[model samples]
Target: MWSEETPSLNNQQYQLLQELGRGRFGTVFRCLHRASNRLHAAKLIHKRHLTDSTDRRCLQVEPKAMTFLSPHPNILQIIDTFEDADTTTLVLELCQRRTLFDRLSDDGALPEPHAASLAKQLLEALAHCHALGLAHRDIKPDNLLFDDANNLKLSDFGSAEWFGEGVTMSGVVGTPYYVAPEVIMGREYDEKVDVWSSGVIVYTMLSGIPPFYGESVSEIFEAVLRANLRFPTTIFRTVSAPAKDLLRKMICRDPSRRISAQQALSKFIFY
Candidate 1:
């Protein structure tokens, strides 16, 4: 529940608009600067959630990674950072094209060409992040955004981490449906996790459904561990065999055997 009254850095003025979204820690609202009429999304993080050391640490990491990612076409542009009371608001580019999830809901599975285009943009973003030693632990469809060009913009850095010197953690975090097997098993993972999730998203985009779903969380975990992915060929029969082979590599049960994001980008039939 974000409001216009939320404070800003150096006492900057803001005119609040509609709430953009709400999450476990805070709500994000669309806001505008009074002086410039610059549109932005203000993310309000409650003080309580920041009390935890992990949360605080992750909060600190956002600015660093985002600043490093500045000016990327497919990355969400963080414009300003400010604080009001106990809340920390990040002024970000206001995107209105809705999420990939919204698009999928409205259009069901996308055709192969569209999916491939989106995947190329996403891979470019991920490769950029990897170059910065950053890993976006969460890469599900819901986090994908669209800018003015209706192009893909991967947002949300709350779970992102750097695998840099003396900083990598073995902890696991991500949506079950899109997570990689290594991440679910609590093993050391790096950029590969994102590649696997992208694979799931690609599959979903083509088939309009997740490859593995189950009755409970436990079952889903098992399915992920075994990489129990099955796609009815009839629907994708027109899709190339090379594309299917790439999917097989992306969803491999073992992370070591899974396709690398760089290779996945060019290996698909469309590429």
Candidate 2:
């Protein structure tokens, strides 16, 4: 059971405002703190939906994980957590500018410089998480939020894993297009999986399309497993050589050869 220390306020302490968005696990709403009148996003997850042990465990892990990365600027901050008999509510810092996915959808592919700037911030955040023995298995643009200042923040930890030395995770989890080949092959993998997803995100940011795509989920997975990564001349013609080099290192088929977050930050010339 979660303790009272996790949540400083209950339902009565805040007024729920407009709906922010919805995901497989829950719905997020823009909220107002009654006393302070400050804005926050509240994620309401139904307890009944988490009937399986794995699903329930993720619910428990999310708050703790958020607590672990709270001080990092590029990771979303959890303000508080609350629960009723029916649902669990998490109070979070609201990113009013929406997600990176929204930006891509509305503005098309980003210019290489802008993409590089966002990618650098993302790698910094991932580096912080990996240093602490955490792997954010999901790293799609949809999970990346932007604050009013347009600074990117990594959000959602439902698929995240915490490991110790020599420990590797084995599971087929994460979005299909972003999942690494090692994960699809059912091999034990570590934090490097995030690097692959980040690579896919960078590819999409520059090309307005994912490196692997298909008409169905199975086809997409097949493409991810066997497809060769290509930088179409139309898109790559204007992109920098250093940027392409970084992308190749990130999306390597062999996880062992995939660039670590720290390496990506130190070796690449994003500008």
Candidate 3:
């Protein structure tokens, strides 16, 4: 729930268990709400990180987006929020399992069925975001977390932005491998950027590697700008033709030609 008044966040309300992970601005901890005795993930973003207007805008947008777009099974839900002079804490649903990135690191690639299942969930979540005028600028394996049931949940709205119909967003956002070509060219873009990133996720799931790569970040950007979508015969020999077709429609370099999240979700590849 959202409120104009900042509620005092104190140790009396929640018992911080342990650190789950760290991000650019905050440390996530496993916490228990004393009143309910229920477990939740608490991300305490320090005020010190609010060094610029951009940082502050992101801080404001993250919680607002989570609160407005959540209660979604495939999108991480925020239980509550708190504020103090030093920190802003977001109490979120606990997804006590590895991220999709961790699974990929350990298991290489997933079978088509498993990949399609997760991809569909991600797309559905994106569809929900786009419908609400929010663009998840950063969509990658690291942001895809799993719950106890291994359900895919899209998380981390630190880079999310709100856009209007027919309007475009500008910025060099998103992770290296999953960033869209339009973003790399410093062109104005829309929600389709997330679709491009999701396509990269699907490609990685099926082939065990990103379609574009480089020895350095610059090289990776160059490869992404080229936007050469390819499937190695040896690696993709077992992948079905429909899956490849779906990837082409999604990962296309041109945002105008790229399929929307809803369109990708309806593709036969998932069914």
Candidate 4:
């Protein structure tokens, strides 16, 4: 939960540089720390959007989640936070190598080995989050970023939720294409939702498209709920058998059967 009291630090401390990206409640900027002269990414959230409970919860959860789970190689590090009357600024580690979506857009589909390597990194990060009782409801390509060496780092924890070991979470959160079936069905779900999303990512990486397709958001939800789980020979012709087997298990409709992030790490190799 965020406090309404004005923070000691404000936006003036950082020199805003380039506009990095924009989200529902905030815009990220590559900024400079005036005192230390270090580069950082600043996510400035407008206070007005906090009117909605969901928005407010997201505002409260993101920083806390980042602070709790960071310093890991694959999770984005939150450097500092500043708040004012109009906005809340979160200073973060600047990741400039672009995102997985950019890489997929430019290169179409990645080779199996390359995709497996990135998938391993992402799964390792998810394992860390799940072990700490945090579920990153959104696990799409856009949230998967790369650093200078192209190491994968998971970002955007706004839709994330914290739960007890056996307890399940409720809510229809996450991108349609990557959302798990239980989520779309409005059933209580555990962190296994992440593995389903990761499975979709692997499918998209192997072929240049997702397993389920629809003309609209509703239609996509329909397809996701159906959980057809198919592989069109035209696209998946070159994908290895083991890789496809892993996708089948990961993307399985039943959350109980869905492979956990830690299990996926051991099963992810594609030689």
Candidate 5:
């Protein structure tokens, strides 16, 4: 748990190594703790870039979400947070195996069993977050990371929200390819949106292509809103029936009908 009393560390404590990646608000770096000699990822969010309340709020939400979701095997763990006048730095556990997006880029689609294992792990992480009244609004491949042991973990909760039972959130947030239909339509959605995004991930892993695609953002939004779910013979001919069934339940157009993360974990697709 984090508190006002958490000790703040100085920049000298970490030896900056290499750039890890860039995000909406800042850049992440691979750093070495000077005293512990441990590798960690540090997210450096510049205060100057926080031009609006929304940007600042996202910065605030990530650390809080991490504090709530940590200690889970499938969620990224934040070691510490330090704020200076110019930047807010998050010290995080370094995932040596990189992100699922990188894996997909290098390996194309995964075999059914491999995809199933990754999806199951992702569901476990989502289940943990949802159980705590938190919804990870962004559930794309890029946010799914793996440690040196090839254990998958979910990261990046900047867009996450806290909602109780019977609560809903309204906003058009998320990558176009993975956004739920209800979210694209600007309807009040809940944690089910994460399920929908995960479904799209499953489809991509099996077929090596996104379920919906278009040349323009507007066209993609339209496709998300009205696209029929189909597993073409060319792609899904070899996919198991149970997997397809699970995907359908997750990616349903009606958010109310979408499978919950816990229910999804119980599906035979993971068995």
Candidate 6:
């Protein structure tokens, strides 16, 4: 991981513009293609995150999802990908729009049109990945990217898996808050996990809080496993019935009963 003080890869040809932010595994910097002056986001992964067994798994799966989804307008662009002697670097499209996290923290609840727009962009990008037999496994506010126009883009699939006839579970992974109960419990899961996480994300965005929370992590996990969904009426009184209905379908505890992403795209509230 790069600190503002220490950038791992030493390519003097690449000019650093500024630090965008830091994530679990690394720092991202706004950079310029020295020769062309094109702006980009450069994701720098830590040497340990690339070499360690657990972190390596995250590193491996992230690129597959990124490369597969890179072409979509609703997905972060991978201007180029390269690995150094120590770290992995991705030259990416610079995103100017504030993160959904920032928006929710600042505005509390997003407007209906804004929520719908983000949800639509996310679903389309997700549908494209699912069609390619991939499972993002992790979907939350932090994973969504936005441009200067607030146009949505999907990012950070480090927990993704290539799910096909018989896929490998790089290991039980994903942030607990956004992870599906089945995946957390080590039960066999599929792309449906992403749908569940997306449900949580949408709920958070529209309602101004996550569907469930606890003073401690164990309680939070219990709530998720038991499907103890709650509503803070004060926060969601103005949300439409159609929106609530969609949330229920996406977050259904039983994967067998949950609506698929493609089916969700055609649902009533996909506006």
The TM-scores, one per candidate, come to: 0.90, 0.93, 0.94, 0.93, 0.93, 0.90
* Residues 49-151, model 5: lDDT tens digits: 8899888889999999999888999999999898888889999999964588888888888899989999999999999999999999999999998988899
Q: Sum up the clashes in candidate 5.
A: 0
Error of 6 at 188 (Å): 0.5
Residue 47 displacement in candidate 6 (angstroms) = 1.1
Q: Please state the error at residue 232 of candidate 5 in Å.
A: 0.7
Model 2 C-alpha lDDT per residue in residues 131-181, reported as the tens digit of each score: 999999989999999888888899999889998799999898999999999
Worst 10 residues of 2 by lDDT: 1-10
Best by TM-score: 3
Which candidate gets the maximum lDDT versus the true structure? 3
Candidate 6 residues 59-88, lDDT tens each?
Answer: 877776687776888888777777767778
Question: Between prediction 3 and prediction 6, which has the larger lDDT?
Answer: 3
Q: Residues 1-271, candidate 1: write the lDDT tens digits.
A: 3445643444457766677777777878888888997888877777677668778877887867787898899999998887766777787888974799999999998888888889889988888888788899999999999987888998988788878754555787889888888877777876778888988898888888888778888888888887767768777876667667878888887777887777877775456
At residue 184, give the lDDT of candidate 4: 88
What is the model-wide C-alpha lDDT for candidate 3? 0.90
- The lDDT of each candidate is 0.81, 0.88, 0.90, 0.88, 0.88, 0.79
The RMSD of every model to the true structure, in order and in angstroms, is: 2.5, 4.2, 4.5, 4.0, 4.9, 2.3
TM-score of 3: 0.94
Report the candidate with higher TM-score, 1 versus 4: 4
